[model samples]
Target: MPITRRSAMTLPSLLAAPALAQPTRPIRMLMGFPPGGPTDFVGRLTANGLQDQIGQTIVFENRPGANSVLAAEAVARAAADGHTLLFASNSLAMNASAYARLPYDPTTSFAPIAMVATSPNVLWCGTSQPWHSLDQLVAAAKAQPGTLGYASTGNGGNGHFGGETLRQALGIDISHIPYRGTAPALLDVIAGRVPLMMQTMVGAIGPYRENQLRPLVVFGPNRAPELPDVPTLKELGHEVPDSGVWFGVLAPAGTPPPFVMRVSHALQAMLEKPESRAQLASQASVPAYLGPDDFAARIRTDVTNWADVARRAGIRPE
Candidate 1:
């Protein structure tokens, strides 16, 4: 059955369901991005926590291609036996609208286990720019219209969605410059090739602290502890969609409820640990756990929200 908000849940127990034996082989968790990036760091942190709780080795393999569509499709087709999983970011939802047709449904193709953490995307600009704040940048864009542009990791990534949403809400005319990776895209922003870039906290924190990039506003539920001085979109009096990148796990659909719950409870226990939260804090992410039901609902809602934004913004699927 598809995981829903109505799905029954309980505290994790090692022996809660002994009828289902743990997989004898190492569990494979697939993601779209290659190792050494922010996603890999988060995945490694999670693997360290889940390995001990689940008593099984987990391997995160990189299947990078087409904004993780390739990886998601693989997970959707894998055996629904809880042995294979998708370690996804918020891009999972955006993928629905980013593409014309996906082989699997973003929400229903798999069973959501839990959301491990969320990293807010901040608006970054070079110090050379005249706009010192998000409001000033908006005003400048309004005055110049198409003269300004923003860069993102790619066409359908969170940065694209964020930039477009900001344009739509504030009525600005900034073009989007997509790059294959954050390193290149960020370099452009720092070089003044692009005036603004909505970047993940994890990816932008280093440059920000080095005084290479200036953060104007944050796109998240609440202000991040690291950037306490920065104002969130909510604080800025703009009701933007929840487009921040979140890290989570999901099992292919048809995986037994017991198997699904097993992973969910393990994630809950992991996130509940102080050390785990500390690790996330180091990465510019915070613990934001939502069990199977809520995780499913969140993915569903995000997919809907991104699609609506794309429709309103006339963002055609690639």
Candidate 2:
């Protein structure tokens, strides 16, 4: 039978019917950090909002190791279905420069979804430390040179990079002490094992509030709302602005465009919720929602920027 215009239109609709009829499944959000860390904390929070809006359970799977390479590789290899997602942070962007070789291409291995939020890295000193402010700390580091030790969550983490940047910018020689994680580093700082550390605002807030650690400066363009008393690095004559960690979502490359938009829209809707905003604020994080294009651009910019920092600091991954 010859197809008429009406039948042709109906044929197109028939082809689309199966796609529309497919049942939605639970989305798996892969996080590269262990539970209770900043990345995992934000991942779980965002997952809750996503689940609420998408009407599907968002399961969080932790595949932490090798500076998040394990999780990144897993997500990179996963099918480009909307059901699997990756919750990533600055580490993913930084790894491009930090590691000499990686199994996955950070820029092209995944489809950028949305930038979730940015948080400052708090410049903290042990409560027992003599330095009262950032200026005092810088002066002390200059005076002591390599004797002044600063702790980091790990060798290639944001905290380490932040500390390294400060060292290079201020022309100081503070020693870098690597810890397994931020909690252990914070504990060591509180015990006066190390004099200083650059920690995420989420991890440092409680210690700062309790006076276990003194926040001297925040690596943000402006003072964070939770730490109004603390000055920014820029305020202290450092040109460094907003060199902190950011969290974002990504899907394996080649995921259908509709699926990407669906997840992105769900995240944007979640960010608009009053409760979500409140929860993020309570952790000293400001919610930032950057769509796919903008988020990918930011990632590229950061990778280049941190690469320079790594070069200046003479850091070479082992």
Candidate 3:
């Protein structure tokens, strides 16, 4: 059974696998928001699920600033090997309309992987504030006009635009007060520095439970189980806008289609797992899974619609 060097070389070649079957490198997932935020909560859940499903190491990096534009730009410029991913949200869609120019194009700079989860925004006010319901808040704003002010995480953010959408829908005059992030905004609200704010349900859930913030209404299609007594904007006799925070995965544009499809399928399978769904639900994130094409379409639609909203609201670039 003596084998020559030529025979040994042939055996090794026979056992070798194709390039596509080889293991992929570790992935880096970038988040636009700082830690301890809703997006972070959802991002970690997704990253873990994807790591398990893909059998690859996934590192989550938080590059918080300018409402995720910085992180978006970083991901857009990364190698399109399906290794670098951006944990994008509706904020990116808003940025498309809010900013005159971005380092990266939202629609064309990245390939959509899959839509992960979504959570409705809640209309909340300081517990000590006068208004307890949406009607009362609107009436008070009508009486005070420019005197009423609201706070948001930042300029041209979901909370800012959500408040603007409500104002336009109801014809109210309220000034906006933009904060560096949600923490300061919530602090000001609880301290009565501002009267109202429209924030994500997940972010508001803690303050609501602690009785520091009052939930006036949920801005989604259905009532949030966490705040069941609160009615939706539609139920309160106002046409609700199609606006809410959504989390999705995206890789740099020009990534191979096969690689994109592989990530998409892995994400779909991960979200379908019961444990994954439960983890997301516990964070106030509703499971909303969309494939690559549909996810891309949703982002496009959001950017276009938010552009219209920002235009009507006279929200110019910052």
Which candidate has the top score in lDDT? Answer: 1
lDDT of 1 by residue, 271-296 (tens): 87889989889888888889889999
TM-score of 2: 0.91
> Please, what is the TM-score per model?
0.94, 0.91, 0.90
lDDT of 3 by residue, 1-318 (tens): 123365445433422334442237878999988898899999999999988866679999999888899999999999887679999998888898888889988889999988988888888899899888888988898988899888888888888888888989889999889888889899999999888888988777778778999988888688876787989988877775666788999999998776666667667767778898888878777878887899999889888888888989999987
Tens-digit lDDT string for candidate 2 (95-204): 87778898898889999988988888888888898988877887887777789888988887888889888887788889889999888889999999888888988778
Q: How far is candidate 1 from the true structure (C-alpha RMSD, Å)?
A: 3.4
Clashing pairs in 2: none
Pairs with steric clashes in candidate 1? none
Clashing pairs in 3: none
How does each model score on lDDT?
0.86, 0.82, 0.83
- In model 3, what is the error at residue 32, expressed in angstroms? 1.7
